[model samples]
Target: MINLQWQSFSKEECAKKLRTDIAKGLSQQQAASRLRTAGPNELAKPKKKKLLVRFFAQFCDFLVIMLLTAAGISFAVSFYRHSSDYIDSIIILAIVIINAIIGVVQESRAENAIEALQKLSSPCARVVRGGKEYAVPAEKLVPGDIVILKTGNLVPADIRLTESSSLQVEESALTGESIPSSKKAETVFPPATPFSDCRNMLFS
Candidate 1:
C-alpha cells in the first residue's frame, strides 16, 4: 500500500518522498508504469444480478411459498371432490404467477434508471504530466500526479496540497457542511484531528 503521511510532510519533503518533480510532475513513461502497478483510481461498482436470477428471487418470499403450498393442497382436495372445483385451483395459481412477474419487472426498471443516473454523474479531471497539462477521465489518475483544482471542479482523488492560492473546497459530501471550506498548504494538524477539520487534504 502507498501509505504516505502527507500531513506530516512539507511540500518539498513530499516531492522528495514521492520521487517526483513538484513543478513538472511525473514524466509520461513514469506515470504509465505506476498506473499499471496500482490499477485505475476508481470506486468499485456493485455487480448487477442477472435478469433471470432477479425474477426467480421474487418467488422465494415467505408469502409466495405459503401460497404455493396452499394451491397444491387445494388442487388435491378439488380433484377428489368434483371435476369443476379443479378449475378454481388453476385460476388461483395463475394469479400468483402473474403477480410475481409484475413485481420483478417493476423492480428491474427502477434499478436500470438508477444506473443511468450514475453514468451521468461521472467526473473528469485535469492533470499535469511532464510539465504538460491534459484533461482526462478521473479514473486515469495515479499517485504523485499533479492535479489542478478550480472552483466548481470535483476533487478526482485523495490529494495533498502542494500549492494553494485562496483555495476553497465544497466538502458537504464528506463533512455535511453547507459552506465551502478554505484550504491552506502549510498547516499540519494532529493525527487525531477529525477529517472535517483537515484543511490541507481533499478527498474524492
Candidate 2:
C-alpha cells in the first residue's frame, strides 16, 4: 500500500492514494501481497548483549577509565617504593568492579521487564477485509487495511483516520501529554505539522 503524508490528506485522497475502497477495504489477495512486501507490523528488537559484554561496557565510561588508570599508577608506585601495602590500588579496583556489577544487574532487570511488557500487550486487531470484519493477528496488518478503532484499543499501526465519532485518543506514550487528543477524520493538517498536532492520524 502507499505510504505518504497521510495526515495532510483528506479521507478520500488517502483512499485513492492507498488504492483501497473505504467501504470494502482490501481484498484477501491484496492484503496478503502487501503483508509479504511490508513484513510484520512490529518494531525491531535490539540484539541482547552477553552478560560479560555488558559488564565490560560499564568500564568504558570516562570516569571508570580514569579510576582504572589511577589504580594502575598507584600499584606501579607502590611496587617501586618496595612497600608491601597496595591498599589504594586494591580499593579503587574493588569500587570499579562493584559499579560494573550494579550496572549489569540493572540492565538485565530492565530487559526482563521489557520482555514481560511485550508479552502482555495486545496481539490482535479488528479490521475489514473483503467487506467482512475480522479480528486478525496484529502482525498481519498491512498499510491499506481498514481498521476499526474503539475505546481502549491499542492501535496496531500508524493509520490515517477515515471516520470518527467523538474520538479522543490517549497519546501520552507518543506525545508525553496526559490529556487524550481529540481526533477528526476530516481535518487535514498543514505540511511540517508536528506529530503531536496530527489529530487526523493514529500511531502504533
Candidate 3:
C-alpha cells in the first residue's frame, strides 16, 4: 500500500509527481493512489477514426488524380482521332493506372504501419481500485492507483515500485536485452536514453 499522506497535492499533482518519481521509491499505497489517476497523469485519447474514412483521405492526392484524369483525356483524344492511335491511348491509360496503383499501395501500407505502431503502445494493465481488482483500458488509466503487474501482461504505463519480492521484468522492448530485468525502486534519468544501464532501476 502507498503510505501516500500526500497532504498538499491534488490527485493530478500527485500523479505528476509520481511519474517524475517512478524510480524514486514511493510506497505501494502512494503509488496505487496515483494509478490511472486523472490530473496531469494522463494522455488524452485521439478521436476514433474509421478505416474507410482513413482510406478515403489517401485518395485526395492531387498528383495521382491528375495523372488519372490526363490519361482519360488521352483515351478520349485517341478515340476521336483514328484507329491508328490505339497504341498511344493504351500507353497513356497504362501510365495512369500504374501511378494510381503505386500511390494506393504505398499509402495503404504506410497506414498499416502506423496502426501496427499503435498496437505496440497499447498494453494491458492489472490494477487495484477501491481495494478491488479492475481490468481497464490502458488509455483510461490515470495515476494514483495501485497496479499489479506480472508475466504475460504488457506494462501499460510507467510505474514506481511500492513493493517487490524479486520483481523481474523483461525489458527487451526498451532495453534490447533478451534476458529480463530485475526491478527495484531507485532514481533514474534521461528516460529516452538507449543505454541499457540507465533503465536498470525501473520497468515499463
Candidate 4:
C-alpha cells in the first residue's frame, strides 16, 4: 500500500522529509516500512452499506402501498353494492398497477444514483503514487494524492493545491458562478469574498 503522510507540512516540506529520511543512512524500503508502521499514514476505511436490506427497501414506498389499498377498497365497494362495474374495477386496478410501476422506476433510478461509483474516465492523468508517477483510475484516488492538471480534462478530486502554473476550473455547479473561475494555490480567509473575487480552487 502507498503511504501518504500529508499533515504538518507543505508539499515542498513533505518532499524534503522523504529525501531527508533516505539520506539518514536508511534505505528507501526501510523508510517506507517505518512510515507504514507509524499507522497514521493511511486513509481511513469507508463505511459499508447493507445491500439486501436496501434492495428490499426499494419496493416499500408509501405511494405504491397506498395505490394498492385504494384499488382493493374500490373493488370491495363495488362487490358489496352488488353492482356490475367491471369497467370501473379495471380502471382502478390499472391505476394501481401504473402507480406501482412508476414507483419502482423512480426508486431504482434513485438507488442507482446513490450507489454508483463516480470516476474520471480520463484516458490520461499526471498522477503521483508511491512516490513515483503512474496512470491509474480516478476512483482509486484518496486525499493527499497529487495530480497534475491541464486543459481538456476534468479535475479528479478536491485538492488544497501546493503548486499551480495557471490552474482554472468550471465551477458552475458548486458556486453557481455562471463562468469558469480562474484558480491559484494561495490560501484565502474563511468566506471573505464572493465567487467573483475568490480564485483559489479548481472544481468539477
**Candidates' lDDT values, in order?**
0.83, 0.91, 0.57, 0.55
Better of 3 and 4 by lDDT: 3
Which candidate leads the pack in lDDT? 2
The C-alpha TM-scores of every prediction are 0.81, 0.73, 0.48, 0.50
Error of 4 at 4 (Å): 16
Residue-by-residue lDDT tens digits, candidate 4, 45-66: 5564355554445447677566
Pairs of residues clashing in candidate 2: none
- lDDT by residue (tens digit), candidate 3, 1-204: 234333233333444765533333334455445553443334565765565565556546787577667766877787777645666657766766565567667767887799799868666666675556767667555555557777577677665555556667777877787998775533334435443454323444
Q: Per-residue lDDT for 124 in model 4?
A: 45
lDDT of 2 by residue, 99-151 (tens): 99999999999989989998777478999999999999898998889999888
Instruction: Give the range of the ten consecutive residues with the poorest summed lDDT in model 4.
Output: 19-28
Arranged by TM-score with the best first, the candidates are 1, 2, 4, 3
Which portions of model 3 show Cα errors greater than 4 Å? 1-86, 98-123, 186-195, 198-203
Candidate 3 lDDT score at position 200: 29
